[model samples]
Target: MGFWDWLTGRDTPPPAPVPEVDPAPTEGDILASLDGVDQLISGGALPAVVRSRAARVTRLVRQTLPRLGSLGLGSYDSYSVVATATDYLPEAIGAYLRLPRDWADSRPVENGKTPLLLLIDQLDLLGATMEKIYDAANSTDAAALITHGKFLQERFGHSPAADLNVPTPPSGNSPDPFDLERP
Candidate 1:
């Protein structure tokens, strides 16, 4: 039925039009490239190189936090604006830092550090995993992972250390997805 007809109660509203957005590439497609690389790392399903890169990136961002905070306006809101405008560097770093050691081996192997390297690597793997999940139809597991990544990407993507001008908690009354640890 046409919209005009439905509006006049002549017929029920036609089904809502499906969005035209293109589906993102699948996880299987990217996983095919990673192959057994994930298994080689401490996390047993994340890439080590990606972890190293994420740690290095986070370290650099952490160094800039002080300078960024000191910029003009010097308010939390200003910090958020500047941070979000930059790039996803901060988020990548935050995700690396927030990763549970248990998931990637709590003990550090090199430089007397815990296996943070492995954890960071897992974040990179997670980015790839997100790309796949975004492409596929909704699954409980996939939804959970995507929700986690989205929060990390949105919250820490700009400046993980910078305080946002929102309430005590970023999203008021919003349930936290990360609170549920993936086992």
Candidate 2:
């Protein structure tokens, strides 16, 4: 080492820590995670705002779950639903829950918002996203119903009623209302 470096007591740099990332959850995992989050939300003594928003996210996820097939198994919307359920919503709530209630609700952590406010904003975003995903999933069925109705109308809507000619009794000779003798 140089004299100046030695005098300065320079040392080896510290190693950078790697960020920990959770693996992407599967569809089944996503569903299970939603259930878990539901239990957490219901079981915990969270504020009304937190509980309500959490409910909205879980409800949307459940409503959209069965229709994910219609959205295409691996498509972006499907993936979004899964990620929100398994990652975003859970992580946001979990982080807020980890903090003490008074401090989380009162102390501004970032951008002039308390942890509670931050969490609410995050949950709101998640809820809105899930709402969109729900609508997209349901649109598949709605579109099919519309298409089928259109098909039915095309096949039957414009056809004329069949003409059945009932011969009127010989003009001015009609006698019997119920029955007439036939020659």
lDDT of each candidate versus the true structure: 0.46, 0.86
lDDT of 1: 0.46
- What is the lDDT for 97 in model 1? 44
TM-score of each: 0.21, 0.69
Decoy 1 TM-score against native: 0.21
Candidate 2 wrongly placed segments (more than 4 Å): 1-27, 158-183
Candidate 1 per-residue C-alpha lDDT over 1-183 given as tens digits, one digit per residue, 9 for 90 to 100:
778987788866579998899453233432332332222333543345664554443333333333433333445433332332233434444455466647545666666555556445545554453333323323444678889988987887765446655556675867777878644
Per-candidate clashes, comma-separated: 9, 0
**Candidate maximizing TM-score:** 2
